[model samples]
Target: MRPDNEVLIVGAGFGGIGAAIEFASLGIDDVAIVEREDDLGGTWHVNHYPGLAVDIASVTYSYSFEPNPFWSRLFAPGPELKRYAEHVAEKYDLTRRMEFGTSVTGARWDDESGLWTVSTADGATRTCRYLVTATGFLSQPSTPDFPGMDTFTGTVLHTAAWDDSVDLTGRRVAVIGTGATAVQLIPEAAEVAAELTVFQRTPIWVVPKIDFPIPRAVQRLFARIPATQRAVRLVNTSLLEMLMVFGVLHFRQARLGNKAGALLARAHLRAQVSDADLRRRLTPHYDLGCKRPTFSNSYFRAYTRPNVTLETDGIGRIEPDAVVTGDGRRIEIDTLVLATGFDLWDTNFPAFEIVGRDQLSLGAWWRESRFQAYQGITMPRYPNLLSLNSPYSYSGLSYFTTIEGQMRHIGRLFGELRRRGASTFEVTGEANDAFLDEVTDHLADSVFYLGNCAGSHSYYFNHQGEAALLRPNATLTTLRAMDTFPLDDYRFH
Candidate 1:
């Protein structure tokens, strides 16, 4: 079969862009990137809420290969990230290969043709020699199923789909969920809304954000000497590595580090919030590293405002004009903002139908058995299919770190395929099982297994209570493994 493209990536986000860059580096230029959204930038393009910004420091949030020396702040805002995405796409000449507003419904691997036939929502089909699903972990937004949500007369909005025309100034707004997204948005909403009510399902670990503007001189220095920026990135990455490796991943061996992190967050809360009762309600009961933490200088202080009320009572139900708590108390509000996060394991694991060898559905197989990806990229039956956002793929604090690691994996895997003069490659079942065992053993020392994570409804843990989201290794270690994983583990055809 003559394939339309050598490679077809199912996302236009950073992950897809990185995969395309890797494929190009391997001298395979026939690539196409399809995005469901009308534009690139993935999350940056889809989310445009008031106070959206990168949770990690700007120095380490981006790709190491294409470092942007002109970040305005240490924690750059959402717009800057969007701009950075645009810059990277243009610089890499990836824009020409992207198909915006193209929603892929499913992909099926043809045994006879040895090509992946991708189906789009628009009834179009494209067959490619290789298919890479770069769909992000948080692509699918989860809306709550409240009893009376259909009867809500007031304007409702999800953080994923923010309507800017509807202003919150002087509006009686009730924001639900207190995750990372809400932490950044609540403070901004509190300043403008007449009465802001935040419904908390679980209290998040909040630490002070050491965010500040980078001076023009520093930017110039970074541009002039790229090595200087690399040094700063290295320093920042190391600090975050300590937090991830010791404070989270190795909780059993390094409990002190985790406790210290918890203490820091508690202290930050105490300093910002004067009310002891409020502080008690705001503090997370679970361990600090159980759930993903956020850096916020104003989240705790937002509850101090007379206009902002922290509602700890579980939501009983919703009415057209007010929110009824489990205690039977009702709070009237004009706007309802659902900061409720994404559906990960369910809707976003594969994000779309993927039928591999012998008509084995990727999502179904994972659900019936267990979610496993050999080195977080390949499965036994999935020949020439690279699931970029698979379980245990994410390494380190920054998403870019994960992307770069996968890029390295792609480079090595594809180079071996070329050397063998092969058109398709699939991971051996033994290799996949071995990798699964290794990661599972490594996670025994992690916060999910060793520390108290009972109350933390973290996305890290799957339905089977396995914390299979993160790679559970030091960032550097994961990168090395990605580059050096045994090529013999895959059977080239």
Candidate 2:
């Protein structure tokens, strides 16, 4: 682990593997890709809950550069997605260059040597010229400080850390949170558990999912004629872009699109739930697209089941054998399932010291200025360190779109390093300021700020109450910019 390398990639998910492949393509041979898990796949490797599936369509969510011609469905399950990651790893010969079961504890830049001192938990350290963090936004699981959680005698589990061995059959299961994961799991939980109680803090808009298996013949055709698969991907991407235009770009269209979407959701809810009281309880008061909209057909139908119970009073406290709601009802349960979301905006990321120029830790910098980066890639003071999917770097439906932009951006930086015969480069403060200012200018047009999601507790907004997670730009716009973006905005030394 003390071996020095030219580049170090942390987290072997979509971002990390993609970075390694891009770097190698650019003749950057000396690279090391590390994963904390015993295997790769990051989130896909970790979250193994029941009824898990991708919300976004499979074609768009996957890598654009390396297309999977034979996806089982339009939206593949978690294991299939993980298999795709593994497929990419093997295809690109990335497995040979990866260090599994290794966690990066800290990264310190040595100004004199122009190398990043990357420290691992195993008391090992390596100094490399370039550092790339592909540690995903949804990497860390968020479990709230539920009162008396430790005292609970029965099995308690986060959806991210699902225990398959736990006997959900005939057990009274209390599921906490009603976000995307909750919606997906509730259907499955209701089928197995004797009594299923889903605790809802706030209702999220759930719409009908458009999903069906890709026929084996079609898969064969895609495998044989690559153009056919490309056409399918193009159509999927185009459709998603249209949604982006209506929901994320234009104000008037966004408003209309949201209204139509809400109407559709209401119809779907009404169709599924027979009980008027239950339907009313399930209906969301907030505007559509406030939280990340879920795509599920089975979720609403689960509420119609006799075993299922939807609790909207909110949780007051958690006792040893029961959960007390805000309405003072102590619902007894043998098992607890936390479909709680990830720690994206409020996470203590890296959870280790990252010292850059002037001994400035990234933790301290973020504390001062909430997660600002030059095009969400490079920071002002952190030289030769690139974040693959930082704040203000979002694009279309899936993260693969961001990875496509980042790959191009990373290539450009490396190109500059080779062309100018420079050792390192850091983003200029002026450039960082200008980039974010543009983001602010365009923020007013998007649904995040214009319509309603800002008031909602969506992870799209940060702890400072600013919509800092997503960049207000089209996917193509971001991708084209990354192709030959101004390298002069960085100080090459």
Candidate 3:
């Protein structure tokens, strides 16, 4: 049977947006984008807490092809990012093709027809020739199930879904979790809250953020000569690459770089907090790169405030008007905020159920066997399916690097399919295994393996104890491979 559209993208975020632009460039216009959120911008739209900004430099976080010349700061705030997403969508004419407020439930592939039937939450189904799941890695929010949480009478919030209507001023607030989100939020909350208590399960590695506003003259220059911005982007990418390659990935080979990074973070902490006991409690026990490290100018200083109390003692239970600690200490609060990160390995791996050839469930296969994907894009049995946010797909610290690299992969792979006049393409099991093994071997020397990460409650290591989220390679290497990977890696029919 003929499909409803040539391509069906399962997200409207940067990943899905990049895929749409790439396909449109390839003369493929019969496409549709489905977003679960009310609008686009994915994470930026969903997360609008007091202190929401890109951790990576603004120039590096955006698409290299479509650089925004008017970013207000070095690290653009959440609203600016949302506007950038809108601009990209409008420029590419992808806004009209997007269906917002639509949740996809599952999808099934038909071997006989070579078509995929995607079921949505509204009991509607759409058939397409190619299926691309770009649901993103952080789509599902995880809320800690502390005892007596339901009985809490005070206002509750999750950083992923912050309620702006509720006034935080003069409110007694308790924040749970100290991941990247909490690092950005605690300072902002401390500024307004009458009293703030932070519950830390693990102390994050905090580095000083080098942030400054972009001058108008510089913005105009970038707008006039795009090459100037591209040059700046290259410099930023190179700096981040050094951190990822030398300080993290090559932990065994470049232990000095890793140790330097840890020292820098410790020095930053020492300079910010004068209290020795507080500094010790805030210092991370694991390696610098074990968990995701974040740069912040005020996160450390927030703890120095008199109204803010750092609670290292574990949470015992939640009461109606207070949080009881493990040491039997009760801290009263009018608001409860959960900054617990996302559930990546479980519900977020695929984001939704996907059945491929031989009735192989994508999520189940990853859990039962291993989370493996060919070049982090395709699986052995998943014909005509492009899993953009698959295992080992993320290439660099900047997510745009990964998105653009995947775009190149899509372009090259589809170019080959068109050359052969093929309708169906599936990666050979040999190719999948080979790619998985290559990446696994490369990660053997990474901080995930070599460094002390026993105390890091990191989501980087999956349930099977594999650091399969990031592709252990330089950004340039990953891009080059995307451009020139062997076309014979897949069988086309």
- Which 10-residue span in candidate 1 carries the lowest summed lDDT? 143-152
Candidate 1 Cα outliers beyond 4 Å, as residue runs? none
Tens digit of lDDT per residue, candidate 1, span 388-491? 99999999999998999999999999999889889999999999999999999999999999888998999998999988899988988999999899888999
For candidate 2, list the clashing residue pairs, or say none: none
Cα miss at 68, model 1 (Å)?
A: 0.7
Error of 3 at 393 (Å): 0.4
Q: Can you list the residue pairs that collide in candidate 1?
A: none
lDDT of candidates 1 onward, in order: 0.94, 0.85, 0.95
Candidate closer to the true structure by TM-score (higher is better), 1 or 2:
1
Q: Model 2, residue 21: what's the lDDT?
A: 91
Global Cα RMSD, each model: 0.7, 1.8, 0.7
Ranking by lDDT: 3, 1, 2
Model 2 residue 150 CA deviation in Å: 0.8
TM per candidate comes to 0.99, 0.97, 0.99
Query: Model 3, 1-493: lDDT tens per residue?
Result: 7799999999999999999999999999999999999999999989999899999999999998899999999999999999999999999999999999999999999999999999999999999999999999898999888899999999999999999898899999999999999999999999999999999999999999999999999999999999999999999999999999998899999999999999999999999999999999999999989988999999999999999999999999999999999999999999999999899998888999999999999999999999999998999899999999999999889999899999999999999999999999999999999999999999999999999999898999898899989999999999999999999999999
Model 3 steric clash total: 0
